[model samples]
Target: MNAISIKGLSVSYDRKTVLTNVYMDMEAGKLYGVLGPNGAGKSTLFKAILGLISSNTGQVLINGEPVEEQRKKMVYIPQKGEIDWQFPATVMDVVLMGRYPFKGIFQRLSQEDKNIALQALEDMGIANLRSRQIGELSGGQQQRVFIARALCQQADIFLLDEPFVGVDITTEKKIIEILKQLTDKGKTILVIHHDLSKVKDYFDKVILLNQWLVAYGDTEVTFTEENINRAYRGQLSILHRTTLD
Candidate 1:
């Protein structure tokens, strides 16, 4: 079934166009990768779907319902560099914030919520770092902390932006393993990744964007050399050369 449907999505800032007439239908229980050149409005598309930014025209539906209504089912993990490392919070505190959606603004987090956060940390293999300061962790550990936070939310859809940026190879592999496990349980996962080499290995579907929807479908079908050339415009020619060699 289609877990996400984006139709005619267009976004602009002060009358300057960013994304133009984009459309895509993402299926459930699949790992999708959003690939494009820099400034291709990749992050803009995510924000539009999340209603974190206003769109000039179009609508995003999750599970056939308005995106707003499916907030609990969707969780976004932004780039680790975007987060302030100096934010005086512990690893446990950061993960527990995911439970905020389930409570009133004035309500406090319960012991059960804390337990859920701890378990999420354990699931991410960061249980030992629970009491450590967020800023004191390594890049991979920081990434795991945010991912654990998302797991604590128990959302059915995960939107991760540049998750493997500066992490170690082992950490990246671990994260992918966990993501696949989540998909096996019927959760949908979308990742915004820059590396073209890992797309086929990591995602079942690929959404190639270059300020618009260039191509989107099964990885084997849509990630053709033609589509890559069209979306990346000669910038990814090395990928073709490497594949043929």
Candidate 2:
């Protein structure tokens, strides 16, 4: 079954139509890339899929169930700057927060939870950053920390928003590797990537959107010049191409 399915999805902010009728079916166990220029409603689409916002005219289904009730299986990573790392928290504390769903609101972390969080950091190659204050890291390091937090969630699906925006090359490579490993194990990944150059190597599927659904399908067969022209008005689409070597 597909990991996510959206039909006739639309969203408006203060009466301005930010997203128009959009339809998409995202499969499980593959890395899908969301490509578009700024103001393309990429984040809004993410929010809708997570039920963080209500869709105006459609339903969002996860594994054939409503997203709201099935959120337990999905992990979402917002853009890095959205969080104020200066809020006085250690890396461990932040990553461990992903374990909250498995615990009562006021419950303390279990030994198992701690182990999961640590394992996530280690798998992400940032175990050394566990003891540092969150705000003390570079942009790339900060991005990895959030990805680690998502990993700690232990969900079957991951949705990362602009994770590589300001990260360093080395950290980006690590993040991509981690994503590849997870999907290899049958995990679903939907990532919002701003760099249009690396989409080819990073994602198996592509959803080119611009406040509306322009294209959605396999990367090689779907990212044609005609479809991109409709989405970006014919300007060379940012095809963030990369390959794992």
Top candidate by lDDT = 1
**lDDT value, candidate 2, whole model:** 0.83
TM-score (C-alpha, index-matched) for candidate 1: 0.94
lDDT of 1 at 213: 92
Candidate 2 wrongly placed segments (more than 4 Å): 235-245
Which digits, one per residue and each the tens of the lDDT, describe model 2 over residues 47-115?
888888863778889999998778878888878778887888999998998898889878889999999
Colliding residue pairs in candidate 2 = 196-238, 196-239, 196-240, 197-239, 197-240, 197-241, 198-240, 198-241, 199-240
Question: Model 1: residues >4 Å from true position, as ranges?
Answer: 237-240, 243-245
Question: Distance (Å) between predicted and true CA of 211, model 2?
Answer: 1.6
Over all chains combined, what TM-score does candidate 2 have?
A: 0.90
CA lDDT of each prediction against the hidden true structure: 0.88, 0.83
Each prediction's TM-score versus the true structure: 0.94, 0.90
Task: Highest TM-score: give the candidate number.
Answer: 1
Give, for candidate 1, the lowest lDDT window spanning 10 residues. 236-245
What is the number of residue pairs that collide in model 1?
A: 0
